[model samples]
Target: MRKRTVGTGILVACAVGLLVYLAFNVRLAPIPNAVAALKTVGMTCGSCAGKIEKALKPMKGVAGVEVDVKGGWVLVGYDTNSANPETFAGAVRKAGFQSWLMEQMSLADFRRVTGRDFGAKVVRSGGCGTGGCDSGGCGNAI
Candidate 1:
């Protein structure tokens, strides 16, 4: 009976030690900075948006990318240290579409292009539309 008790105690102690070690060693991966969003022209259909998203998705530092055909915007999440706004634009251009890093366009413009506002809140936040308007004149300048 004493031997069984000792064995059980040892097992319990080992389990507690394992739990503590795991607790100390386990770490969550750092969340990467997202690219936020970039407004561009020439995205007129779901397939167009898909092409843009596919192009940007594999670039270094890109965590997530969403291209809205109706909204004419590409919302991207990226690791800023690994990529930047320029890189994102380049990716879109490489995909055969003209792209630029324009500020978030007006809700009216977004609606006109995309037909919906998945990124309307970002526009409302007022950080968008700060960049220069693109050649297509979908920005605040007009």
Candidate 2:
């Protein structure tokens, strides 16, 4: 009788442990697919980036926000089910910054404004006329 009771208690303990393990290991739903990038204009300094980041950070469904001062762009990652690009654009405009959907801008214009070179450099050692490059290399200034 004693051996049977001990065996039954061990079985119950094992069952409870398995249930707990399964509960913790179960996978949840996948994250939504509403991520997008926005290009902001008229941002001249780091302070401008801070203002834009602060404005968008509090909005719902915003997963992440990055402001590139040199690139004059704001990249936003969001959940489409909860928020849309139009809403995000509105938030940027309200902060006194000009913003447009990244898709609207032409690739050529983006490269020009950001000062990014897509092709080989004509001068290997010399910097661009815009003073973006120096002895250290190309600075982040755009």
Candidate 3:
């Protein structure tokens, strides 16, 4: 009677809520006006870049991370209020690589010298037959 009506109403509300949740896409909002550029030394291959990315991407306030293996540069977009360039540099160092701030003038000069845009997005996700070799040169981890 009354109990059955209340249960039916609750079930309908739950079904409507589930529909709404499944119909919409949820994502994190991007940060505006914050980009950190780091000159990373010792990135010899894509795996190196992947390791660096894996270290920095989980940090708080990091919106996006882009690595340029050929240019030895890492660009990180984040919220300026919660993160800074120094944090990224430290992460790179912790991952066993030296890093430094690429000043505006230096960045421009590097771009000119390399004749390639440094800001291009990097794709470091593992692919078929992509892996690094050990010091003994046993073999690549393909």
Candidate 4:
């Protein structure tokens, strides 16, 4: 009789714990102070942008993602402590797209040149072959 009462109490406690876990939403702190601008190859359209975002969005400490199809570049805003230019570049590589890091700049410079916050806008234009390198072969991807 006592064992049954104890087991019932344990089950109720577990149920309550599970409910609390389901009810609370996990919050990730945004790290938005630095930007990693990378030059990409073989990225030709908005679909390419989506792929890049998919690769980068789940990375820890990444705050924002922006892709410029017209320019063949991807800009990632992230927390310096948790991610760096290499983290973004490596993820793109794993996603099967190659990337060359252009520069890592401060959020101020990024906003100044882009005129907006990361993920707030994207530059999608230019024809394929012109999209990533080969604008008469842009720098030969060197």
Query: Which candidate's lDDT is highest?
Result: 4
Cα miss at 141, model 1 (Å)? 28
Name the better of 2 and 3 by lDDT: 3
Instruction: For candidate 2, list the clashing residue pairs, or say none.
Output: none
Give a tens-digit lDDT track for model 2, residues 5-109: 999999999999999998998644323244456777766555556667788867876755667656666766556667666777778888877787764223355
Each prediction's total of clashing residue pairs, residues at least 3 apart in sequence or on different chains, is 9, 0, 0, 2
After superposition, which runs of candidate 4 have C-alpha atoms over 4 Å from their true positions? 1-29, 124-142
**TM-scores for all candidates?**
0.49, 0.49, 0.58, 0.68
Compose the digit string of candidate 3's lDDT tens values, residues 26-128: 5454563456778987666667777788888878777777877666788776676666667788888888778876642233454566564434545453332
RMSD of 4: 6.6
lDDT of each: 0.61, 0.61, 0.67, 0.76
| Comparison by TM-score, 3 against 4, better one | 4
User: If the candidates were sorted by their lDDT against the true structure, best first, what order would they fall in?
Assistant: 4, 3, 1, 2
Q: Please, what are the lDDT tens digits per residue for candidate 4 over residues 2-104?
A: 9999999999999999988877866575768899999987676556677778898888888888888666788888888887678788888887778878899
TM-score of candidate 3 versus the correct structure, residues matched by position: 0.58
Cα lDDT of model 1 by residue, 67-136, tens digit: 6655677776556566666778888877766778865333355456658653333321212243332443
Over all chains combined, what TM-score does candidate 1 have? 0.49
